[model samples]
Target: MTVMKSVPEAAYGILLRNQCDSALDEAVEQVRNLGYAVLNSGYSDIELQAISDQFDSARERYVDAYGEAKLRSIDEYHSVRSPLTHGGGVFLNLAMNGNLLSVLKKLIPGKFILNQQNCVINPPQENYNQGAWHRDLPYQHFVSTQPIAINALFCVDDFTSENGATFVLPASHKAEAFPSAAYVRKNAVQLEAEAGSFLLLDCMLFHAGGFNRSQSVRRAVNHVYNIPYFKQQINIPNNMQGADLSPEMKEILGFDYMEPASIADYLLTREAKKY
Candidate 1:
């Protein structure tokens, strides 16, 4: 004779297995319930160093290309946009990490696009543009049944109280309107995490970068991944044309979701096109 557990018992066992099998289940749940979560990327010291170096080089190259005056004039200073186009392999590798992707897959169903990837630097004791509270999907004031996008910010340096770490209003993703100032003051939490850890948040969550009171600058790489229904911040497939990328990465970057040029093109399958 054999015995089978009840439905609730079986479900509990499956959930336990999922939690144990992947270290990210709890973190994912936190993001679902609280609008944010901190996740470790599990990269080695040497790898994290490479990523840091890449971030510095990318920012320098961007400044050189655009000129500091031009960047400041446009209010885009200290930020490197689309670093993956010019950054080293480490940047791309971090974007394609299996663990991070796994957490994303759990949160967002179906195909998603890399809306944008940029490097942000917070200067010590200086007022930065991102210091104010805002949602990643700015200007939108509605709540969705599920997350439309996720922001995975990789901390290049250890995020500390002195070095501007991120701060968020917990569970604000469920609220359609921003909370009162008094509520924010009481509920806001500063997230301090080690280098190489990701400060993951729902795109709708209201978050801001804390002021860096330390003597050193703090750097972070931000990646916004959203469902393909929304347009990318930049035309990634067109911008990174001729660049070598794995098939999965290509699809994730919106290669498969690009709009067709003509009726014939529209009729063709995604694979048949040369995009």
Candidate 2:
């Protein structure tokens, strides 16, 4: 089996420099080399606080609809799916973040679609396991000539080793075959980052969340983006119906680039003059 080479530790220093277009390019190179990169201070403290507040409000609503016990049984912890529907304003801002988008464009050159927006809350508990090791795009073994999917995990709470920080197998994105269970256990490294940091990852990378052994909960918002040809995990356009949105937001949500397939579609395209 072929194994991908890992990036050197020194390359991560590029992310610590001043914010500029060159720095963003360096960060993207780090992602290509290591399968992931951590951007410290990607969001402001105030922005992070707003995200946490929105998460708390959404959690309450989820609990009211689905009992806490039911939620716990579904997964190791609580997670809000398609959070943009509930946390639209704040998450929309995050999706369109200038710096973040710049880095993403490097990975996926042309127009891309927002596939998913999920918020995960890992509460403290003894022997708590987040989930089995898995990929966001599971069961696919072939490597794409270009990136097919990518993830931006925004930390809402400082991720510590004790609080279920994510564990990743460096350079695994380029591997053509999956590693053995023992091999994975032996090589996976814990990723610790502060609140307001962004953990950008190639979706095919092997990773899993660490067990939360702290006194408080760990929170994060996960954004998964993909090539335009693939359908979004959620119908973002339908979800935002009747809501006001900017042209760029509509484009990212896939309103502007719907491919015309049938004669009816061509007629609609002509009527709207989208092409």
Candidate 3:
């Protein structure tokens, strides 16, 4: 892949707003040019504090129920899967935020669905790297005509170089091979942002989390969105069965749309819609 020698000015700390056409355009351009875009102040101070509190409460409960040792045995870092299932109202509201949805709509034209949601907590430790460089998509050495998947990372705490900020190879989304060691050494850049900022990443971009050398912990929530044709990591509709959900929530969760399995079923669906 070809790397941009200079970062686009619009890629740094772009402020996001609901229904702002120019801001949305700039964000899209930056992502296209650099494979990622940073939006500062994605959430308010009150919202960030509430999310942090909720995360703490949830972490305590998880540790109590499963034991800290058990969690660590599963992985080197503390990761909570499907936080939306139990993250309460604050997380639900954040998932459905208008500004976030607007930006996603611009990046992904037509219908999209929530593919995965998880929280990663990287506490200070020696050699604290979580995973090797990888793409969110299961496939490799492939390029899509349009963006098939994207990640929206919400920083629950300030992301700094010492606290394990994400590192990305700019414009690597177009690459058909893994980055060489020398190329990565020269091109990889750390993304540092304040709490409540959003880092929108192209799913194919080669990236990894940096080591946490600081005394403080780093926390982030990753929400991956994909085109509706792809299968979700978790069956959200089945898991959400019997829960009260609004129309918008149902749509975002992919409960309101589906591909027909057969021609007869497709015909039936169209015929039913006519009534």
Candidate 4:
């Protein structure tokens, strides 16, 4: 969201530095100019740094638990890619998926969920060839006229053109249909940024990972935000529901006192049912 158009970009930037909130208008402009904008910001540099540190830690630990080979298919540029591309992940189980949904209920206090089940990814083959190229959640929600997912790709390392940074087809969301590989081959834009820089791409944009021949590792975290009407790639309210939620787990799911009626509801609702 944006703060206000009347607020000078300088003021807005200051506000951003001080956690000044954005108005939807400012957000719209940011989106128009940069394709995406920061919604809410944290405190100091150390605070934001800590968030990335913890996020990276979680990723490495998870990889340790699940062998790199197991998720290799996910990192592929073509083919099945990420199961989340179709809605599945390492957190597919009942207890694990359930606990997560419950806690989102609280932090957001409504029904916003992180849907971490679909968050896993391993990266391309060590050789790092150019990707097949595609879009993120190109599918539209039944209710939305536009592409449903607002994608945030968090850089886990300094992204460079040589090391397979993710690429985006600028303004592809407005395209009526996905382009042929030949078209993407003709013109594709890479999104290169420093580690800690978050690139938000319109989910509909045709995209892929560039080849990475560098010795350094390339890593990233992508979060897809969508409205409730779209079919979720991963089922959030799957096996666990009802009273199965622990209080702490519910807090994480953003669920307070009730089980979500549907997976979509569990993920998109910002206003929880009031007691």
Candidate 5:
């Protein structure tokens, strides 16, 4: 996949409003090219506000449940939202339709996993500074891969330049690994999008959460989707059974009535194979 030469956000909305698959294809291409992309859609102020309340309630529940993690030192490191949510986010998953998941699946194929990541950030007070630059996908994990891995960043709070919005290197997904030691030849950019902007990024791209100079807590949710056969650190383990979903929805969740098969069954025989 290559960087989309044109900005597809406007076209994406136009096409999506019309349910144009062809336009979505173009948008997918565009997302690939840029090495990362952001979709500012399907969210309203009311929606974001509600999500904020959920997070607040979650924090209280987290303290009640985890007990130890509520401590000032321990709670800070709870990047993922599962324990915090008291077993939720999956409901948020259900809110995302299978139609959308199917579209992403077709665009990315057997290379993506759902509900694999989350983040809740609290900036340090009394003059905080930078976070070390890094890529979302580690070096050993990909073992030097070029196919784009995506990390979905959903802003629970408004991502401003003042606050700790994520910064990314556009088109840096081509980089072999996290170029931590190298000096970037160009200026790194901060994604100053508003709340609910789902920032989808290629895992190879170099990025980090910028320093939050604001007083308010800066919260963001990260969902890293990777290619199949790769090691998965986090997974969506929620029970979908009896959930308000159609048969098609379950299929996207890999519940398509699959049977076990041997590796030999999948491979071509030596005699039939063309070397």
Candidate 6:
């Protein structure tokens, strides 16, 4: 093994001084280097309460529609998949929050799409689908030059050790392969954050939900935003048709990139983009 030594006089003061100038800069830097960052969702207490209530109702609605047995067959029992389909304007607003979007704009560059949004409820003392270590992209083992996707998990309840907050392997996004079992055991970190905070993660990060030891369920809404080339978990534009949507909202929700019905339809869109 080669021994390593540091240079005694290397300069790092200017790098430290210029590192992060604002909250946004800090958040971006943390997510880039550490693979995750916690940010205030910027929703007021009343709004947070509203989101919690809405998520509860939406989860119930989904459970009723799908039935527990069917959902369990797919390993998604208590989770609400695509709550936005029934969550009304409140969910829409959360998806379009300016604070979250500003961070996304810096991280994603030109454009990104809402790939999926779901409400995940970690029942006290029970298993959830998210317990396994996996990337938000799933089944992929490559690192992008830049982030291809991001996960903004909005905490609907306080995430705590007692309640089983998320566990993350720091800097795992920068690795092309999963670390050794011993390394994971030594390095896995559980993040605790208050309600109404967004746990921002690079989609490539290796992470999992911890087992809830508290007496109450812990809930969060997870939104995965990805580059437009990736297919969405649900066809958002189709599901959201007839709902009043701004041009910008429509574009972000992927209205602009839907597959065309025919060659003629494809040509029409291609021609329209020319101007």
Q: What are the root-mean-square deviations of the candidates from the true structure over C-alphas?
A: 7.1, 6.3, 6.2, 10.0, 8.5, 4.9
lDDT of 3: 0.80
**For each candidate, what TM-score against the reference?**
0.90, 0.84, 0.84, 0.54, 0.68, 0.93
lDDT of candidate 5 over 68-137, digit per residue (tens) = 4455465444354543124355435523534335436645655454535445664745222225567776
> Of the candidates numbered 2 and 6, which has the greater TM-score value?
6
Ranking by lDDT: 6, 1, 2, 3, 5, 4
What tens digits encode model 6's per-residue C-alpha lDDT throughout 1-275? 99899768556546444367778878988898889999887899999999988988888888888899999998888688788877767888989988899899888878899999988989999988788899998889999878889999999999999998999999999999989999999999999999999999999999999999999999999999998999889999999999999999999999998999999999999999999
Segments in model 1 whose C-alpha atoms lie over 4 Å from true places: 1-21, 270-275
Worst lDDT run of 10 residues, candidate 1, spans 9-18
TM-score of 4: 0.54
Q: Write the per-residue lDDT of candidate 4 for residues 10-118, one digit (tens) a residue.
A: 4333333323243434544444434544332223456446544554555565566565677465653311222222222222222133322222221122333333322
Model 5 steric clash total: 4
Worst 10 residues of 6 by lDDT: 9-18
Error of 2 at 270 (Å): 5.8
Give the alpha-carbon lDDT of every model: 0.90, 0.80, 0.80, 0.48, 0.57, 0.91
| TM-score pick, better of 2 and 5 | 2
Question: What is the C-alpha RMSD, rounded to one decimal, of candidate 1?
Answer: 7.1
Collision pairs in model 6: none
Query: Which runs in model 4 stand beyond 4 Å of their true positions?
Result: 1-27, 30-60, 68-130, 138-147, 231-275
Residues 1-275 of candidate 2: C-alpha lDDT, one tens digit per residue: 99999966464435465333576777788788788888764666787788788888877886777777887797624777777776658878877778788888888878788888888877778444445677788888877767788889888889899898999998899997889889887889899998888888998888888889888989888888888877777778878877688887888887766666799988888888753
Query: In model 5, where is the ten-residue run with the lowest total lDDT?
Result: 251-260
Give me the displacement of residue 170 in model 4, in angstroms: 1.2
Which regions of candidate 6 are displaced past 4 Å? 1-19
1 or 5, which is superior by TM-score?
1
